[model samples]
Target: MRIIIERSNLLRSLGHIQRVVERRNTIPILSNVLLKTEEGAGLRLKATDLDLEITETAPAEIEMAGATTVPAHLLYDIVRKLPDGAEVKLGLNEGGTQMTVSAGRSNFRLQCLPEADFPDITTGTFSHSFTMKAQALARLVERTQFAISTEETRYYLNGIYFHALEVDGASRLRAVATDGHRLARAEADAPAGVEGMPGIIVPRKAVGELQKLLGEAGEDGDVAVELSDSKIRFTLGTVVMTSKLIDGTFPDYQRVIPQNNDKALTLDRSTFSAAVDRVSTISSERGRAVKLAISDSQLVLTVNSPESGTATEELAVGYDSDAIEIGFNAKYLLDITGQLSGEDTVFMLADPGSPTLIKDGGDEGTLYVLMPMRV
Candidate 1:
């Protein structure tokens, strides 16, 4: 294809599409991005890694209408390093085996693959569709993504579980993620057409990609979501992303959430996070465990390690229940606390061994359940 595109616009489109290209590919075409130019439709760019695909379109001055595939990362890097605001001209060579990229004083030729070799990941028929504010979807991802499991054995837990549920007699869209050690749950008001939607486990990579797109779209834009039994699609502006959902069923996360954890402790979110950070400095690298000794109106954070020295810090909190000592992974505590947007954090605890429920005092839609660690 022959097209003239603005350097900045091409760079942005490439940045979004190339993320799906695997660094190392078993199939050569999987590492290349498909570029197609049309008379009135501008330029279309597509990249995929078998399971996920991202397609974006940008307005470009078309000189010739054709299609070709080129190394995604290499093209991205070339466009990125080109002078800003410079116009880029890309054309397929006469042999149809190479693509030439020209921008100002710099010129490069990249080997091309037949566009027909690219795999198609488009969905056939979506059973359910809904629209949500970009900011709300982004918030849901940020709050729960940290708890997604990295382990491969339990493949079902390697992504966030999204479903519709009733909260306080109101319908809400909930996102939940857990890795056995800790869990994060966030809810947003359910939009129209989402009632009775089946729970879907979105893969971790897709969640991250969607987050990036939603962040770029900002708070004002709306994201269109289409879901089927096996795949899900997200459309933001001129970009469309399709991903395969995990095939396994997610565990019953609500069962692990403490129902009657009545012992409540309220403290400054930042102060508590800082104290945990300070104490964790001396914690062992492997466990990274920090002990929380809570009593009436007082909380002491301590860490003891064989290689590193012990650390202890005290902070005044609003705990009126009986004294209890609990050990937790310092990193887990910090991760959950960082998600809090409000000044105060609330912890509802049952005892030292049971899972502790955490929440931002100002937001009832967000919640966290952290399993205790042995000191």
Candidate 2:
């Protein structure tokens, strides 16, 4: 298409859209970013990788109205390296088989693909659409994304599950991710208008993409999230991202959460995390098990390995329950601790073999579940 756009704006949109374009493609058109010039306003840019698509419209001066596709990544790199604030002019050359890009003192030409080759997603019934503050979405993703499973056998667990639930008569949105050994759950107030929306699994790759956009969404702006049965869409001002949902049922995570753990221990989060890191130095290479011995008001973290001797560290806690010994993966414990936003953490224990429930202070909406290891 023939259009003139600011170099900075074009690069910003390209940076986001080109990431969805695959480096190696069986279809030639899939490797290009479709650019269409509007009659009087701006230009539209789109790129996809079969599963996900990103479209952005930016202000541009239109010459002749037309559309063409150029190499997605190559075009992005060229514009990114150019001087800032440069005005870029693009136009269809000779027989419309190629488009020329001119900016500053540099000029380049790229072969064009027919705009008809690009695929379109007819967004089906949007069962839910809502607006949420950017900060809330960021917090929801930060707390639970670390625990997403990477195992291939349990394909369903490879992504974060976004679902709505009622807790204490209040509507809340929860994000849960687990790899079987450790689980993380984060909750936030559910945005209005999505009370009955179906839960969906957001693949890790898509989650990463969304996070990048949300980061740039500005703290004051709200993001509009919409979803149908098969696809999810995120609209932030001038940018829009759409992706296919993972077709899998997430497990009933509520059942896995421990219910009756009465032994409560409160410890300084940083100290405990450091102790776990120190003692785990002697843990075995495979399991990386670290033992926790708690009695009266003292907790001792220890680890033993056949090749390496043993290590132990003591920390003062606020527990009055019967003395208990529990073992857990050092890495898992560290992850749970990393979620703590404050200094003190609360851990509930039933016995040496049961799951431990960890929470920061009295916050019940955010919790961590960790299975004990047999040391």
Candidate 3:
């Protein structure tokens, strides 16, 4: 292959495609990025690690149309270090096996693999295809991705669950994720004609890649999404990302949310979050439990540890019910607090050791459940 591409465009595509390349590969070809030049005006760069793949095309001046593979990370670093606006020229040696890259005063040679060695991805069989605003997709990931399970044994909880639902006679799209300790559920009005799409479990790696791509596409741009029973794809302008779905059934999370919690406390979000963090210093590492003491208009957060001492902080809240004492993990409390984009947060409590429900003071479509800890 002999092609010339702008330095900035080449570097950007490298940054996106190289992320899917594994650092250590049993097969040498898997460590390389495949570069193919078409008969027309652009070059396509692809990288994969069996589980995920990223393909992006950049406009280039092609003298000869061909394909070759080069070490992904090394090539990316070389091009990135070059001066901006410089033109990058790539060519195959006389034997057509060794590849050379040149830009500015720097030059490098790398071993190449044939195009037939790269794994082919079949994107023609998607059962569902839809489009939505990039900002909406980014918001869905930001609102619920933190609750994804890190435990390897419970494979079903390892990713966000995307499904279609109906709310108030209107279609809605929802993203749900949970660890054993907490659950986060967020929903938005589904785009028109996206009502009957089947549910899919998007693995954690794919979620991360989509997040990065969406960030680059900006908030106003729209993204096209395609999915099959076994794979998912996201297309943003000239970039495309595809990955295999996690083959596991997610547990029904609705049963765990408490429906009858009568006691409610509304507090300034920053004040409550600060109190929880300040008092939890005395909590033991195992439980990290902080006790909540609520009265007429005051709330107290206390943490007691046998090894350490005790710490307490008080806050003024909107509560007018009987005194209620409850315990919760400090980490869980912080997770819920960090998800808040509003000034005030509401907490509904049932008892000392039951599940507590939390939501933004003004929104009902997003709800969280945190299991309490014993004090």
Candidate 4:
């Protein structure tokens, strides 16, 4: 393949595609990106890690229509370092074993893998398809992705759960994630053509990449999503991403969401977050418990560590119930509060051992449940 593409265009496509390539690959071809000339269309770039694949096309002046594979990260780095506005010329050697990249005075030769060696993720016929504003999808990921579990044993909890639900006669789409310690749930009005979709678990890696691509498309742009029980695909503007879904079943997250916690505490989200942050400074470990003492209208946060000194902070909150003391992970508290896009946050507590329900005043469609820590 021989093509002349603007450095900016080539770099942009490379930046998007190279991230899917793993830093270490057991298969030689898996470390390379497949580059093919599209005649009048443009130059197509593709990279994959077996489970996930991303493809993008950039406008280029095609000299000879052909295909080749080259190291993804190396190509991205080379194009990224090229001077702005420079034109990048890519040419395959006659033997088809090497690719050369040239821009102005810079030149580099990259080892090439046979295009035939590249693997493709077979995307069978999709069972359901839908389209929604890119920003909306991005927001859904932003809301719950932080709660995805990192444990490998619970493979099902490593991704966000997405499904179609009928709520109060209105169809809605929901995204949920939980790490056993905390759960985040966000819902939006379901877009057309998403009915009868099976609940799918989107792996953490795919969720992160999709978030970046959708955000780049901006709020005005629309994203096309297609899925089956085993795989999912996203098409945003010129980019296409296909990923294998986690085959394991997600646990029933709804049962974990608190339904009837009556003790309520309404406090400014910023104030509470700040107090938790300051008190947690004394915690020697990230998961250390921060004790919360609530009485009348005052809330006191205290953290004690044998290695460090005790830290305490007090704030006046709106609470009306028997005074209750609870313990929670300071880091978990900060994460939940940071995600609450509201002036005030409501915490419905049942007791010291049970989970607490958190709601945002600014967003009614989102809720979070956090398991308490033993102080």
Candidate 5:
């Protein structure tokens, strides 16, 4: 294929498609991106790693209509290093085994593979579809993705669980992620046609890719989502991404959320997070646990490590319940607290042994459950 494309336009599209191409490949064609051009449709770029596929189109001036495949990373790097605003010209060699890239004074030839060798990931009929603001979807991902498990044994917990639920007497779309020790849940207004949508586990990779696209679209832009039993597709502008959904069922996360945590501690989120950070400096690198002592309106944070040292800090909070002492992983506490956007954070506790519930006093749609750690 022969085409002339603006450097900026080509670079943007390449940045999105190349992410799907694996750095290491067992199949030759899988490491390359399929580039095709048509008379009126412009240039089409596609990349896939068997489980996920992303396709994007860029406006280009077409001189010839054909298709070829080239190393995705190499092409991206070439375009990225090219001077801004320069026009890029691409053409297939006469031998059909190489592709030539020309921009300004730079010229490079890259080995090419036959486009026919690329695998097609067919997106079957979708049973459900919905549209939501890109920002809303981004918020859902940010609030819960950090809690997704990295372990592979319980594959179901390796991604976020998305489903429809009734929260505070209103139906909403909720996303939940957990790694046994901690869990995060966030909700947004349920969009139309999602009332009976089946609970789907969106694998970690797809969530990350979607987040990148959404960030580019901005908050006001809309994204179309299509889902089937085995696959899910997201459409953002001219870019289309499809991913295979995890087949295992997600564990019921509600069972672990504490219902009757009688003790409540309300404190400035910034103050609490700062204290935790300071105390964790002296915590052991392995455990990194911080102890919290809560009584009346006083809260104290302490960390003790055999090799480092012992550190303690106290802060005044809004607490009226009986005294309670709990130990928690400092990193886990920081992660959950970082998600709180409001100034004040509330912690609901039942006892030292029970899981503690945390919420941003202002946002009822988001909640976190953190398991206690032994000091």
Candidate 6:
């Protein structure tokens, strides 16, 4: 393909899609980004890692309408180093084996893979389509992505689950993630056309990339979502991403969420988080338990290690329940606290052996569940 695209535009498009290209690939063509010149759509750039694909369009002057593939990262680096505002000229050799990149005094000759050799993951028909405000979607992802499980054994828990549910007679879209020890759930008003959409598990990788894109979109942007039982697509501005959904059933998360836990302990979020951090330092392992001793109106945080000395901190809390002592992973406690956006948090406790429910006072729709550990 021969096209003249502004350096900034080319770099932006490459940055959006090249991330999907894996550093090591068993297939030769999988390492390349496909560049195709169009008559009215400017220039099209695409990259894929078999499971996920990202495509973006950049404004360009098309000299010849054709297509070719080249190393994704190498081309991105070359374009990134070029002077700002320089026009990048891409030309395919007559033999169709090489392409030349020229901008002012800089030049790069890269081997080309025939576009015909690149495999396209066939996207089947979509069963559901909807749109969500970028900010709203960002909230759901940010609140729960940290809790997504990394254990490969429970493949379903390795991604965020998106489903539609009716709450108080109003449709709502919810995102849930769990790693057995902890769970996070966040919901927002369901967008148009999402009423009967089938639940889908978005793999961890796609969730991360989508999260970045949504973050960039800020508050005014909107993301168009189209999905089927097995595949999903997201369209944001000039970029389009398609991915295969994880084909596993997520557990009924409602079963683990405590229903009758009435013990409420309210404390300043920053204060509690800081205390947890300071006390947990006494333990060498992040998974070590940090004991929480709660009574009438006070909370004591303590950490004990066989090799290291014990550390403890106390803070006044708003609790009127019976005295209770609970142990939780230091890392897990910090994670849930970090996600809380409010000044104060309320933890609903049942017993030392059951899951504790944590709710963000600032965000009523977001909640977390943490399984207690024996100290």
**Model 2 per-residue lDDT tens digits across residues 167-269:** 8999999999999988899899999987898999998888888888889878888999999998999899988888888899999998988999999999999
Candidate 6 lowest-lDDT run of ten = 118-127
How well is each residue in 295-328 modelled by candidate 1, as lDDT tens digits? 9899999999898788999999999999999999
**Candidate 2 ranges with C-alpha deviation above 4 Å:** 281-285, 305-309
lDDT tens readout by residue for model 5, 1-375: 789999999999999999988899989999999999956879999999989999999999999899999999999999999999999999998878999999989999999999889988855799999999989999999999999999999999989999997777888999999999999999999888787899999999989999899999986899999999999999999999999999999998989999999888999999999999999999778989999999989999999999988999999999998999999999999998899999999999998999999988768999999999988
TM-score of 2: 0.93
What value of lDDT does candidate 5 attain over all alpha carbons?
0.93
How far residue 248's Cα lies from its native spot in candidate 5, in Å, is 0.5
Which parts of model 3 have CA positions greater than 4 angstroms off? 281-286, 305-308
Residue 166, model 5: lDDT of 79
lDDT of 4 by residue, 93-181 (tens): 99999999999999999999999999989558888999999888887899999999999999999999999999999999999999999
Runs of candidate 1 exceeding 4 Å displacement: none
User: Judged by lDDT against the true structure, how good is candidate 2?
Assistant: 0.89
Per-residue lDDT for 43-155 in model 3, tens only? 99999887788999999999888898889999999998999899999999977689999987888888888878988664559888889999888888888888999899998
In order, the Cα lDDT scores of the candidates are 0.93, 0.89, 0.88, 0.92, 0.93, 0.93
Candidate 3, position 316, lDDT:
92
- What TM-score goes with each of the models? 0.98, 0.93, 0.95, 0.98, 0.98, 0.98
- Say what the RMSD of model 6 is: 1.1
Clashing pairs in 6: none
